[model samples]
Target: MARVYISIGSNIDREHYVTAALDALAGWFDEPLISSVYESESVGFDGSPFYNLVVGVDTDLSVAELSARFKQLEADNGRRRDVPKFSPRTLDLDILTYDLEVGRVDGVELPRGEILKNAFVLLPLAEIAPTAVHPVCGECYQVLWQAYDRDQKLWPVDFTWQGRRISQASAR
Candidate 1:
């Protein structure tokens, strides 16, 4: 099985969709290693705030298959492609890393660019995989996160799943 990390976000009906995403992921793969849910301002567009998090899943699927799966899940959750590239979304799922694979593998970027460019992707990933090394950068996630730019704002929020508290917010 390939160990993979995925980023999940939703700006529309944040709670419901985020929960639904976690549920759907749990159904397909092993129970995921979840990160704290975070609320953050939208990047590249104007829209409502989004709830974002990272999940670790061990799957036998290839990167191409995983990419297709995510797209299907997003569509099922009401994601609209007619909107602009950075417009609001009901659900957004992107593969962050697929095992130790690098560059484009099977049409999917092995290590997603946003993992370093966006706090929404990096923070939660660092939280869950502190010691996991970046395939390209060759540094553990915690170290990369320590050197991250803080201009883009994001914070953890209270989130529950399956009647269990999975994330807790802190005073900002």
Candidate 2:
């Protein structure tokens, strides 16, 4: 099985949607490294605030297969990607890292910018994988996240998904 990290975000039906997505993801992975949920402003386009969290999973599925599975989960949760970038959605699950496999496929890129520049992704990821180094920057996730501007606010919400606790901090 390959180690995979996925970032999950939602702004529509805010809390419920995020919880559902987390539950769905937990069902698929053998051990889900879930991060504490955070609230962040819309990134690329204007929209409602988003609830962002990251989860790391060790899976046997290939990248493409995993992507398809995520898409299916989104569809089930009422995600519509055709709207606009950063628009509100039921769920947004991005494959941040997959066994360090790097390349482009069908216009979507793995190991994308979201993993590095976004605190929403980095902070939670570091929670799950404290020693996990950034594939490109060669720095630990916690250090990288701390180096980013602290001005941006990412608040913890009253949310928890259905799964065994990977860590005490994640448990509600």
Top candidate on lDDT is 1
How many steric overlaps are in each model, in order? 0, 0
lDDT of 1 by residue, 1-172 (tens): 9999999999999999999899999999877999999999999988999999999999999898989989999999999999789999999999999999999898888799999999999999999999999999899999999999769999899999999998999999
The pairs that clash in candidate 2 are none
Cα distance off (Å), candidate 1, residue 97: 0.3
Which segments of model 1 are wrong by more than 4 Å?
A: none
Question: Residue-wise lDDT of candidate 2 within 1-172, one digit each (tens)?
Answer: 8898899899888778887877787687766877787877877777888888888899888878888988999999999878866577888888898777667754458677777777788888888888887777788888887778745667666664565432233233
Candidate 1 global CA lDDT score: 0.94
Each model's lDDT comes to 0.94, 0.78
Q: List ranges where model 2 is wrong by over 4 Å.
A: 105-108, 163-172
